[model samples]
Target: MHQSFISYKNFKSLKGSVVLCAAVLGLYVVAEPSATSAGGTWLGYVGGCLGGVLMVWLACLGIRKRKYKNTELLAVGWVSTHIYLGTALLLVVSLHSGFHLGLNIHSLAYAFTVMVILTGFYGLYAYSIYPDKITLNRDGMSRDSMFAEITEIDEKSLALSEKISPEMFAKISENVEETKIKTSLLTRLFSDRSLKEGAIYKAIDFVREQHSGSELIKELDSLLQEKESLVGKIERDIRYHFRLGWWLYLHVPLTVGALLSLLIHVYVVLFYW
Candidate 1:
């Protein structure tokens, strides 16, 4: 029974978040201030202040993570707090604003906060699932080893294709040149189409359709099949790696936006309200 950050310390962070939200909710009810969208009442100010502190602390997680040697702040515990407190911030802020989302800076801050939290949840899920998938996909083979084997197969396939016929040699050679094992990031992220376009696939198709069941043809076919399988594995590995990290591109910018908006929000609330 391995416990993850979500269940770290027997769900201590979660319990803390629950207690925090409950306390805020109880205060909001007991105070029974005039239902207003802005943070004008005593309870609203308390919720706003608490939410602000939580948001700032959560944003500091990046710094804490980078300080790997800082044992006083365990990364796992910080991450656990970041997750649970982040979720609680939503409730705290909602109560602070009295659930009145309007088209203003206040609402903009709220919107950005919500987006950041949503992206954080996506990141949590991605981390939970993709690491195991990546490990399983790699198995015992390194990417470099798999790639070297593919190149070896290509060379062997080319040699066998030459022995068969000039047409076979030309097709295999052309396919090899066109086969891009190291491709663009966009190609890796979006399409595994390169796997289908390799020399091995072309050779296999050519052998099946144009040649008889000679021993040479059979050998070439075997080599091509092996190469194709190896190429498939490489494509999958690339895909898994990309999927595991791609969300950060969105998550990071959203988090920055949220933080900036929150600062402006605090300033405006303090000075204007």
Candidate 2:
């Protein structure tokens, strides 16, 4: 019963995009240019205009999404339209170029368009997959709650380790001090933090070395295991969080670059060419 942005209004944007692409394809097929089918021709001009409009509209989606009041369009509808029309814009641009590519500013604009669209595709995939993954990883507990619980476990483990031995106490303290819940952006996104696991394993080994089957050691072992589980969940949650938004960093900048290059390309074509 839950309708996602992709399925908004019974795939209305998808249908519109398909129709638009089909119509453009028909025109491209029928148009007979004086020479090559390039951006200078009549149909090519149409395609260029459509592609330009679509590019500007797609870029506006970031602004549209940020508006929270008095907007006529639903946010989901805007997103759905953005996804569908953005794809169509690629084909329109390619046809507008008459499949011709060269080491020129026009091609540079097209290249930026390609990069922006590719990043947008990755963003769409991330949005679809990561939200559920983050929810499952958190399991109804906020990240702050998980960290708070880890701190509590560390305190209890420190007390138990102190009663057991000085070496155990020192090891537990070092582990707690070195355990990192936050890391560098690239590290959080690409690498798993395993220091917490090493500390837990070392503590378990130390307890086993003591050769005592005492309840205090048992409780300490349980706490270490619990801490390990929480740290793993937090690391995974951090990865999912970064994965969801990192593409926007590339996508937005490339969009701005593409728009600027497109403006220069249009200016040259209209006034000089």
Top candidate, metric lDDT: 2
Stretches off by above 4 angstroms in model 2 are 181-196
Q: In lDDT terms, how accurate is model 1? A: 0.81
Error of 2 at 170 (Å): 1.3
User: By summed lDDT, which 10 consecutive residues of candidate 2 come out lowest?
Assistant: 188-197
TM-scores for the candidates: 0.86, 0.93
Superposed Cα deviation of residue 1, candidate 1 (Å)? 11
Instruction: Mark the regions of model 1 whose C-alpha exceeds 4 Å error after superposition.
Output: 1-3, 34-38, 181-195, 198-200
lDDT of 1 by residue, 101-164 (tens): 8888888888888888888888888778877877887788999999898788778878988898
Judge candidate 2 against the unseen true structure and give its global Cα lDDT, from 0 to 1: 0.88
What root-mean-square deviation over C-alphas does model 1 reach? 3.1
Root-mean-square deviation of each candidate, in angstroms? Answer: 3.1, 2.2
Error in Å for residue 52 of model 1: 1.0
